[model samples]
Target: MDPIRTDVDAPFGRIADLIALNARQSPDRLALADAQDSIGYAALDALMDRVAAGLQRDGVVHGDAIAICAASSVAYAAVFLGALRAGVAVAPLAPGSTPASLARMMRDADARLLFTDAAAAEVIGAPGEDAITRIALDASAAGQALADWLPPPGTRPFPVDVQPASAFNIIYSSGTTGEPKGIVQGHGMRWAHVQRGARYGYGPDTVTLLSTPLYSNTTLVVFFPTLAFGGCVVLMPKFDAAGYLQIAQARGVTHTMLVPVQYQRLMAHPAFDAHDLSRFQYKFSTSAPFNAALKADVLQRWPGGLIEFYGMTEGGGTVILEAHLHPTKLHTVGQPAPGSDIRLIDEEGREVPPGEAGEVVGHSSGMMTGYHRQPAKTREAEWFAPDGKRFIRTGDIGRFDDEGFLTLFDRKKDMIISGGFNIYPSDLETVLRAHPGVADVAVVGAPSVQWGETPEGYVVRRDGHAVDAAELLAWANAQLGKTQRLARLHFIDELPRSAIGKVLKRELRELNPS
Candidate 1:
């Protein structure tokens, strides 16, 4: 497990340069595609040049932030790369965020221009006093159309000086409340990802189907690598189980990145096994917890290597669980990746002994620069070892097994304290998930008059099954320690999730009586 070499003098310093190199070598190859359109390597290279020129003409230069709030599309991809080509940083704001939040993010990034499609524009409405220049990706009343926004076809922007430390993009954290913090990633971090991705079989012949939003780091972790290695990427504006299966089979897709919920939906689809997915060489899952049972099912049924990546968007250490190779370690998140260091500490900031759960913190080369314009928040996220090495606090509670595999228990903030005893929600959630009647479940700390804070369970019943909350609670309590018993249980239609399928525990906590 050698570290990914950082080659400052590589043939292509920037990702845009890599795209240009691919165009020169494989002119006729498909560079990108969506349901409605496709672009060749040569044409995509040319389009990127025009887009860079257009931004330059509008006074966008190095270090400037260009905000894109739209659905995934060929134009959206082009604009993202174009901004990078001009040495500008991109802030991919989520269209699903509220208008006020979006406005705050735009201000935080100091974006002078905004690119959006009709649906996103409708959600955002007018820019008002934000003073952002608007360009529409589709027909909309929001701003100028993309076609009119660009300069002539052959136009090229001036040459840029890109360094390893140059700002690359701003990824906003999915905060449960208030304004989200913008995590600033640099070119060096992205370059490390692109270089290391080759071990997973990304190359010129690779065809990656990305169904996640471009706004998410989960998608870009695979998306940028596919293009950097000269692979074709197929974009899905919105995820549909049937459509995903159809596209994968029809296009002979070779690789893909999907969240756990998407995988659950695909596995439940009636036509799941009906399609031919033998061409898939690798599949990735991240951004949420992947159940061990689901991983085993995928390994047994799906025709590809299933790799689960455990890490934060803030980019400290990463754990890679190759379910195909280490079937016995499926319960753990595997060992830390090469060049990554992970440690656990207790509440008093002391290093916890091995096999004892503690707050997970880590250090790695792929770490983000800092939270944009939030120096105090950035400082709060860091921890230091005796050797003076800096580590990012993951805020997760996990312990290493004798074999060095890491098993996560629960988030530090989600831990329940009942009657002066520490309780891990994941320990309780595991028991609940084993129940036949439970389709999905989330455990959160609820206010309890007797115990201060007690564990509560929110459950989604399996289809065609009737479950009484009291009955289910009694059954679950039978398998748990007395102190860990659920104080209350609530039946819900479904768990509230973020766009990337992360369960929103904050929202569930709100449902509990104070």
Candidate 2:
């Protein structure tokens, strides 16, 4: 049975059809916006047709995969939608990655064409991977410009059947080093996401500002929904606190998806309050741990509903924290979303009792099919029940409270085992963050001489607030349990993060491993 129609008896309507409907209804309505350009619904819809026609004219067939490695732009978005119209899978890769890694990913996804821009082409080092052809979104002299590559404006793609299990897009995992895993999400899973647009008040009037990289699911989750529902999406190629505030006010943005770190930065910005963001109807955050204190500050100051989404790109049981309604439950990631079956399991894969922290595994209608072309790794990511139902392993250690709200305890791999006791690094980091001088902090487990593994703290101090590493470590340990005490603490200028603002804990562990 299909999950996208939302109602069990309702016929599934394609998101592309909805876009076409939107175009027919409101041709002049703004559909997409970027720093350099903005396109109305009718023009954007027509552009997609041109893109699809060009792909077909170039011998690209249905079920084949193409890639887009450029930063977010109107052209990038057009090509993506165009590929879907042609029943072709898309692999949206990150331009921030090394050339070798990006090339390797294109090969892995079996991408025959790479839609890129001048900046991204430079990063990919000439796009010299296999027989892949390159088309420049920014019209660089090095490759075929998007304008020239696209078919005539009136051209339309031939119709193709897009079934529930048809491939949608391949989102590469955020592995800073080495070959990243490509998560294959299908059209059905994406349609479910689009169906959820109504919950966030998405419509023709909804304007969303997406500052995160397009490659990250954190950005696409909001991007697809806004466009599908005839809303305008404002893209930010690079995230800047001042620029974001400016865009929000200028665009009259009603919705946005930001990681916790982006929120922290926005909240810390001196001019954040000065911005006129009264149009915001909803603000969504995911992809990293959100501090309760920060959520409180946003609720107190920002005008809109703040929702925290807890789930992975692989799609499993989802938890949604509606901070506006449940003020007291801000510390937790809220209860499982409707129809989301979230459960906890012990080390041996046995289901854990309520209130006990364990690895999170979930089953949902929106879960991914599996990792692309990696059957062994895909099986490793799945957990089967005694009844033979499949669930995705979240790799996050968490617990369900009496009310079913989940409180995460860092990643399962990040959890430290010291003297046969579990030590969650987030627990240690939370305590350390309470210090007045700490601007930011991350705790990672290090190899230990006696305890096998021990917690080590890396900190970024508030400017002009003096606190020695020894003093901060001693203070933190005094507040922590005996087994949870830190083994060492070091001060740093900043905590390293990925493009989407996830803390690089592995880098910290490697840097200070005991």
lDDT of 1 at 92: 96
Error of 1 at 145 (Å): 1.1
State the lDDT at 366 in candidate 2: 85
lDDT of 2 by residue, 17-94 (tens): 667777888999999999999999899889888888888898887888999988898888888988988888899999
For residue 138, give model 2's deviation from the true position in Å. 0.4
State the lDDT at 276 in candidate 2: 99
Per-model TM against the reference: 0.97, 0.97
Can you write out model 1's per-residue Cα lDDT over 1-514, one digit (the tens) per residue? 2111232235336889888888888898998999888998899999999988888899999989999999999989999998999988999989999988888899899997999988898778766774688998875776898888889888988999988778899999887544699999988888877876878898788999999999999999999999988889999989999999999999899999999999998997888999999999999999888888888888988899999898988888888898899999988888899888999998887899878989999998888899999999999899889889989998899999998899998888888999999999988988999988898999999988899999999999989889788899999999999999998899999999988998999999988767
Say which candidate scores most in lDDT.
1
Clashing pairs in 1: none
What C-alpha lDDT does candidate 2 achieve relative to the native structure?
A: 0.87
Worst ten in a row by lDDT for model 2: 1-10
